[model samples]
Target: MSDLSATISPAVRLKGVSKTFGPIQALKPVNLDIAAGTIHALVGQNGAGKSTTLGILAGRISATTGDVEIGGARVDLGDPRRARAAGVVAIYQELTIVPALSAVANVFLGQPLSRGYLLSEGAMQSRFAELAGRLGVSIPTDAEARSLSVADQQTLEILRAIQANARIILFDEPTTALAQPEREALFKVMRDLRAEGHTLIYVSHNLDEVLGISDAITVFRNGSLIETRPTQAWTKAQLVTAMLGEEMGDIYHRRPASRLRDGEPAISVRDIALPGAIGEIGFSVRAGEILGVGGLVGSGRSSLLRALAGLEHRSSGQIEIAGREVAWPRTPRAARALGIALVPEDRKHQGLVLGMTAADNVTLPKLRAIARSGLIDNQLAAEVAADATRAFGFDPKRLFAPVGTLSGGNQQKVLLARWAFDRPKVLLVDEPTRGIDVGAKAEILDALRAFAEEGLAVIMVSSELEEICALADRVIVMSEGRQVDHIDASRAELSVHRILNSAFGVERHHHV
Candidate 1:
């Protein structure tokens, strides 16, 4: 018997599930059975077909050939509505929460309560509030979801799933942007849900979280199931090896700081303030330096990056590039012209034009560079994209594929490649490695280091403290939209703990 077959009965089963996109066999005769009322974790490196499997299960996409059974009954999951009706719900990494809508409204977005044909807003509000309270969250039901933090948004998404009476909930890297406390709360909620007999298929790159929360762990590699073992039977090292099909000694692998003789600032900011929330903020970056911005969700990390990218309306601030003070550019074009580029955190919505091909997406910002006399040079554009793809180790065969067709890490790589060729003087990257696997994270950081080595001022914003500690030459901590502290890489031990302590307002701060 297979290792997975010995553990639990199948609550949801997939038999000979194979999904193909053109030449790419995303899933190859995959067999999966998620046991009922248990937290089952699906883990793998990028492009390992984890999301594709979830998409199929969620009915976002159909399998080429397979049978999906829920409780031993054959299911034709033709659409998401069908999946939901069949007690399946998914909280995707790229959130589906409507920004303009209220929390209650989003919770009951499609399946609103109705009394005699009228929407029961009051009932929805009361139920939402109750759910929120139970989840240890206090987000106002009437407040716009856009105004809520990422953690709140994620909670709302999960609540929606619960409200829909889903027996099997699939979480696609749900806590990628959540703060520590919020993540702890989520883990608690998951534990509570498990006690209440709900099956959860937790997908995440954070191995520790997966191992801690899951009963059974399944590893996928290159569209195939490698090993599906009980949580108790797996070691972190063994699991890491199975996921990557290779041993990884240290995922972080922080290199020694290179020699520096710093006299000039590559980028500088002074008296930066924005309307509503962002208060006085100031910082600077030297050439070949990585500056990390650390803060809890909604603490203005994204806002600061946006302000630097010229996307946000900066109320009062002076930005200087290589000692020359300049006005903040209102348009992205202007920012690009001044040699500044941004990799926005929300990749699906902000980073890539999903409908376009990978080549088209990569060459988007540099269209003019590859164009002549108001006419786009297709050959030149393809060449540029091809070169970038090769350099980034992105599959060239997938070049003609749509940007949406790629995995999270590949999509992120495409985003980086686009900006790399732009040759921006200063690179403002937010959440550069969010939701991607360990190997991909290492590669992305390496690429960033290379970029910095070429003398580009790189400013990165990440909630992951370890990533900051690994890649940053200097780290800045923010709390409530204000810069609280800055530390050099040599003092990472001191800086990381101090930053976290500041983030939590802990008095007993320990550096390291």
Candidate 2:
């Protein structure tokens, strides 16, 4: 398929596209169009049919009813090979690269460079090099995919798409795992692709990125397109209103310094080290305080939290609770016994059992409380689940439903409820509001604030600087696996810019 010439016809068009799964209508009849060689952005909350629409265009899923056109030519929307042949490709958030294979092998996994019965490895590597040079990215063609960083993996996916000569490319949350520099590089590549007449569809939750890189923006709410406007004409507040149907003031409910107590620390760590990953980290969280951990990806923020939770063994460290000296917890059960609970980053894989019910999952950690003589008391378990659901503002009726059937926000709430049931002295949460909608984000923050208000020390790790500034009573900036700067929220100098500077090791000069 050749690129579409300059014409009045749209590069891609969807007419009355709709999707339904069982009794739930994921997407209503929606119509959209993208002009040739332009960067179009699709913005919406989670579960707003963004993924469903992308799925239809990428030929991964069949639309219930609709018509799709590429370069003014109707194509089979249900056939993956047909879509690829029509110059359509998508890069999803969850990477699809084969871990054990080399980057060259993964780029051409199914379509190999073969001469009769023999494969040409040299030809594949040379082709990948050419594509990487064209895209202005440095990708290791000979390295194994599993050894590459998340940002490099994404770059490899983009190189593969370019190698296929795709005229239209779709990116789903491409920068979610990238740092500032990597994001800029990706944006430059996207602009270069547009300059070369490739239609690009960008989807992301970061409004600032949409304004910076998109030419046109489309907002979706409740499975329907709210509006489409030029990026220059749209504002962040307007986009938030369109996606959420209302004004959402301050998503992170930061508590005042007065609310944070100066009493003895609930949890204290001295000289925490995780071998070569992180070195000599020290911090303390008092009751009724939210201590924020800030850093770029791979800067040891997540590793620090894991080490504190006893999920990762520390080479050397002393952990104390309520002024009592205790040995390093060797297991998660031991950590919990010492009044510590960890909410992991990947909630779906690490937090919840998908096949189990919400009530069962919520009360899992506290089974002993609701059991008698090693027998689970069903009524008592249900009551505990009910109390937890109510405390977190989750629906009680949904407790009986399968955990997998719930939305991302509800699933996150289920995890929080489980940890809250234990009444731990300290809570370690990694990315509490990631991949959740704006409204759900507000609710989760409020729940954490409530927990802190009830005298529970909370340690949170997040990549979003805005989240760290909004929710933390104090922020610890980590760089190269070490804490470099500490900013107290009570002081006016604690801003997102300062946090970013600290993370990047940039020295800021203050006017005397």
Candidate 3:
């Protein structure tokens, strides 16, 4: 089957293509071919140029050099209209469905049926039904897109592409918000598409999904293509190694301090529960300690943090601070009054105002401290934000820049720095190094360690197991909204394997 792919003409090919933004090379020159009727996956660490390559192919980005061919025809690489006309379509994580529009209207959004400027409603509905039937899926044509489930909405997007006669479809992290059954359904759809001869380019961080759905997998590292191999020829560990490159230990970052041990209890919770999200969760952490919550997606790790932050209204818990009983906080302001601060998972929507300057975002939590009687003292705010973030390796110059323009790493730095002004005793971080490059990951991890060094009890939730092992002094593994096991690093058994076993509700193995 692998050899057969080579003989069949490639549906898409890149020859010596590269991308650069200002002085930074986002993608190095690369030559590759994506065969027709195959699910090809592109995987790498964050900022490894997979998205850049996809942008060039989708005509959203102009390549700095080289040529792109779609079905043996050279393409004008930076025009979206040309890409669409050439049968190339990109389905992003953020769906393009208009909430108020009916399903059929969304499918034929800009290109509706018409007869001499008169709407042909019957024709549009029939085409919607036809496309849905051809995909072996069903979505009510008259129903509003907002009323549909996320899975159904995604299926609607695919139907839209199919309606446009898209021969090549690109999916970027399609299953990030999907449940197990929805993911399975989407996979079935992809398989069906392949069977009908549509080429797919799948980009994801989820190795399991990539392994299961792809015929071929390609690894990218530091703007370069590392390797491309059949899905059957790779293991998760091998994929990780390839993404990091051989002899690339220098990129790894983790240093848990010895002084973070044996501190007094800073925050203690008993029976924390969020309805439908997390079961009863209870734990304690010292003032200078970092405790990690490890779990699979939907295992209640994030819900636990949300409950602690007082974002979950139905969450009920008994909490104490500094060995003193404190009333359980019901709102975020109440949590702040209790000296608890949560740096939420969705930074764009929940954490920062993207249009605001980084300095403004950082000082937002404690405007009172930086403001005079009537108006804000801008100088004081800037000075405070600048001084407090140096230890985190954030630049003072970027503080004046709008947070939206900053890279993911810098935006995260701004988010973390916001907590400094208010100075919480307990800090909650969700996916601290998510969507950032290796250099920035190290800076973020170091900032976290710095926070611990400053005597703040930090509770972190990380999907990546290695991150848990690196920065966590202790780990509490959760599965299905309940704590399954606890492993302290002091016991010399807090490895990724033991934690993973506990997350899966298996017995922890003793390391030899």
Best by TM-score: 1
The positional error of residue 62 in candidate 2, measured at the CA in angstroms, is 2.8
RMSD of 1: 3.1
Tens digits of per-residue lDDT for model 3 on 109-211?
Answer: 8788888889899999888888888778988889999999999999988988888889999998898667677889999999999999999999887788899
Mark the regions of model 2 whose C-alpha exceeds 4 Å error after superposition. 1-7, 79-82, 258-260, 355-360, 368-387, 390-408, 491-493, 506-512
Worst 10 residues of 2 by lDDT: 1-10
TM-score of 2: 0.89
TM-score of 1: 0.90
- Candidate lDDT values, in order: 0.84, 0.84, 0.84
Q: Please, what are the lDDT tens digits per residue for candidate 2 over residues 269-314? A: 8888888889768888899998999878889999888887778855
Superposed Cα deviation of residue 503, candidate 3 (Å): 8.7
Residue ranges of candidate 3 with Cα displaced over 4 Å = 1-6, 77-79, 113-130, 133-143, 226-238, 248-263, 270-282, 291-304, 310-318, 325-334, 355-414, 417-423, 433-454, 462-512
Candidate 1 stretches with Cα past 4 Å from truth are 1-8, 98-149, 258-260, 372-374, 490-495, 502-512
- Give residue 210's lDDT in candidate 2 (0 to 100): 91
